[model samples]
Target: MQISFEEFVTARGPALLRFAYLLCGDRYLAEDVLQEVLARAYRRWSRIGGAPEPYLRKAVLNQYLSWWRRKSSSEALVATVPDRVQAYRTADELAARDEIWTLLATLPRPQRAVLVLRYYLDLSDSEIAELLGYAVPTVRVYAFRALGRLRAALSGRAPTTEARSG
Candidate 1:
């Protein structure tokens, strides 16, 4: 059965916001993107086919990429520190996570998107390729290169200029 736009948003909005935040690496920007996508989805609600979640998610990703393209040159990289530390986690774990996020922020948008889709979202390479309009091999390459840079950074070595350019 088809659900109304309000109902869908009520149920899925938080998750969508989280996904967008992960993608854009900025909570405010994530909320903006999600709001725009949801507004568009509401206008086309009746025309949207089955599995609206996937459609909405794809829309968020596309919107994020479009926004990045427009403001990339003006964007500043910042380390996103949690406002409150969880009592259960060790300091080292939090530090590592922060370091990884900082490194992730430095990656090119497409490479970062591939890594996020593959690892954070746990989507298969083919699924990510389709979502990003890339070939499977291209998706794999992005993941490989992204991971290589992360590994190099974590190991206290700098990635070569060639790797950075790609």
Candidate 2:
């Protein structure tokens, strides 16, 4: 049975917001993405043919990618402490998170989306491929490339184009 938008939002809003935050890496943008997706979902609630969660998630991902693409060329640099940081923790972890996020933001949208869907959402490669309209092998390649960059960055090496060539 089709549930009302209110019910759907009440049940899934928090989870969706968390997913958005993971994808966007900013709480305010995450909230915006959720709101934007919910607004679209609201308009189509009656005509929606499937479970709305998938539709909502796909919308969030697409919305984030669109925003990223439009702003990427002019994106600003910012420095902030990670939320997970503790007073007792050394600066290394915090610095690592900053570097990671910086690198993550630099990633092509598809790579970021694949990594978020696969790792953040814990979806399988095939599932992520279907969700993102990629072939299974393509999904694996994106994951491989994204992880390679992250690994290289953490090791204090500049990410190389060698991964893209192979």
Best by lDDT: 1
Assess each prediction's global lDDT (C-alpha) against the native. 0.86, 0.82
> Candidate 1: minimum summed lDDT over ten consecutive residues — where?
71-80
lDDT of 1 by residue, 57-86 (tens): 899999988987785456565645668889
- CA error at residue 47 for candidate 2, angstroms: 1.9
Instruction: Write down the lDDT that model 1 would get.
Output: 0.86
Best by TM-score: 1
Error of 1 at 58 (Å): 0.7
Candidate 2 has a TM-score of 0.81
* Per-candidate clashes, comma-separated: 0, 0
lDDT of 2 by residue, 5-94 (tens): 898899999999999988887777788778988888888889876598888899998888787667544545365554665787678877
What is the Cα-based lDDT of residue 124 in candidate 1?
99
